[model samples]
Target: MSIAQIIGSRHVLAVQNLHASINYYIDQLGFSLVWQIEGWALVQRDSISIMLGECQDDISAHETNNHSYFAYIEVTDIDSLHQEFTHNNVEFVSQLATKDWGQREFAIKTIDGHRIMFGQELLF
Candidate 1:
């Protein structure tokens, strides 16, 4: 028997307001709206897709402390991407820097307080 290959993934996030989250992902974060219903939305940029579900009563990601990080996206051109995010006035959790772990990375916080890290592997 042959093993099945895994393809892709979509990160599901519980947001306070579905409409605002969708707008942030689309307008601020450069993601395109894949689809949206009453209480849910899907947004994507390149290969990264996020599913936002409205959960008004739930605690926001910022309150989770260190546990708030959701995704670490690998990209090709880290500098350009960082510049773009900076230009958009995105709220950054951490500034772009090369780490000893062989990755150049940065992190940002969404309007709903979800955190995502973007990185590019260092070519040593």
Candidate 2:
């Protein structure tokens, strides 16, 4: 029997307001709304998809400290992506920097406080 390979992933996030989070992801982050109904929404950009669920009673991601980090997205053109986010006024947790571990990366915080890191492998 052949083993199946794991495919893609969608990060699920608990947000305080579904509408606002959806707008932020689309307008600021350049994601397109895949679909939305009631308290749930799905947004996508390139190969990344994020599922936003409204949970008013749950703790916000900002309150989770380091646990708030949800995804590390790998991309090819790191510099251009960083510039695009900057122009859109996306709230950044960290600016683009080449790490000693051999990656050029940056992090941003969604309106819901979920953090996502975008990185590209540094070809030394």
Give the clash count for model 2: 0
Off by over 4 Å in 2: none
Pick the lDDT winner.
Answer: 2
Q: Among all windows of ten consecutive residues in candidate 1, which has the lowest summed lDDT?
A: 20-29
TM-score of 1: 0.96
lDDT of 1 by residue, 1-124 (tens): 9999989999999999898888888878899998988898999999999999999999999799888998999999999999998988899999999999999999999987888999999989
Query: Scored by Cα lDDT, where does model 1 land?
Result: 0.92
Per residue, candidate 2 scores C-alpha lDDT tens digits across 30-114 of 9999999989999999999999999999999999989999899999999999999999999999999999999999999988788
**Whole-model lDDT per candidate:** 0.92, 0.94
